[model samples]
Target: LRQEYLQHFQAWAKSLGLGHSVQPAYNLPLGMQADISLVEAPELESLGFNEDIDLYRQFTGPAHLTGRNVISTEIGARRIGAYALTVPALVGLLQDSYAVGVNTMVIS
Candidate 1:
């Protein structure tokens, strides 16, 4: 059913002269939270960034296999102190995401 919907949407967009496409969120990272509800420094520490990069490669394997070039997903949202994140820290987080094939991000 999902495949049918995706193809239909793609075809509809193309018919309307739009190049929009849909992709599953196969990113391998936390949504500004770890095992906890509110995100903080402690929660960030539990992120899988320290894990093997191969894990993420596998996580996004499905999208790659389907020929989807754009891997978009939400990040850096719902934090304990959302405004406390420094510029460098945010940059580093994005850098790590890029290393795992995150080209477009929806920062909330």
Candidate 2:
């Protein structure tokens, strides 16, 4: 991620009580719709949740029947890209889980 974007994200997360212990990962799934789930398995695994961490992974694959509550943390800004459009096309890879749908959740 660019330094400016990182600064914005870090500030936003800190204000919301998410600490720096939650490391940020970038550019996952290398083709299209990459940023939709940038903090994927590797990042999540590295977190190794403690009682206070409450770490969650972005959807990695199709949802299994194990009843895990999946959530999305997709946030974006206004720009000149198709992903700057909507949520579905952005997060269509992992098809069967909760989407936490947002057309444009944040624009800063």
Candidate 3:
């Protein structure tokens, strides 16, 4: 089902002239679950699985293994009451993502 979905998405992107520009981005937990369900045993449900950090590892692993040209992620700065994330904090988030093999980022 996942392959089918990817195929259809690729075709649709090609139709819209975005086949090369459209790269799949998977978030932690939910997106990880969807991707793992396609290829792995879904061991995330097992005890001792660290969903927080581990999901990032798991999600990035496949992109590297498959030799994806770009690995992108949606990043957000933590909100503090009335103010949004600080500039330094946002830079920290981008740096962390780069350390984890994310070459592209969609900031929120």
Candidate 4:
């Protein structure tokens, strides 16, 4: 059903000549929460940037698999407080996301 809606929306956008200009938001289930494994992983304590990289992979992997042109993430300073990351750590998160496959960041 999601794919069907995407296709229909794409066609509508194309008709309006806005297909290339607009990017869809591929939100993950659970309103942008990290996967449970990432939240609970013991190795996260020591993994540093690698952990961010891995989490970015998990975030964007599904969108890539589904042939999405623009992969996005809903992340912000407040949203990631549970991770106990510093400001530099948060920057690293965005960087890692781009390094993997996320082309768009939705901070909300």
User: For residue 3, what is the lDDT in candidate 4?
Assistant: 40
| Per-candidate total of colliding backbone pairs | 0, 0, 0, 0
Put down candidate 2 lDDT per residue, 35-105, tens digits, no spaces.
22332211222112220122222323321122222323333332465445467633432232123221112
lDDT of 4 by residue, 1-108 (tens): 544554566567668867332223233333122222122111111132234566566545655554556555555435335656677866876676678876766543
lDDT of each: 0.45, 0.31, 0.50, 0.47
**Residue 26 lDDT in model 4?**
32
Evaluated against the true structure, the overall lDDT of model 4 is: 0.47
Query: What ordering of candidates by lDDT runs from best to worst?
Result: 3, 4, 1, 2
Worst 10 residues of 1 by lDDT: 37-46
Clashes of 1: 0
Better of 3 and 4 by lDDT: 3
The TM-score measured for candidate 4 stands at: 0.47
lDDT of 1 by residue, 1-108 (tens): 444554566567778977653322223333221111111101111133333445445434444455556655455543457676677766766776678775676565
Give stretches of model 2 more than 4 Å off. Answer: 1-24, 28-68, 81-108
For residue 42, give model 1's deviation from the true position in Å.
30
lDDT for model 3, please.
0.50
Q: Which 10 residues in a row give candidate 2 its minimum summed lDDT? A: 45-54
> Least lDDT summed over 10 consecutive residues: which range in candidate 4?
37-46
Q: Write the per-residue lDDT of candidate 3 for residues 1-108, one digit (tens) a residue.
A: 555665566667667866343323332234543453343212221012222345556666666665554665556634344356678866766676677666777665
Q: TM-score winner among the candidates?
A: 3
The estimated TM-scores of all candidates read 0.53, 0.21, 0.59, 0.47
lDDT of 4 at 33: 24
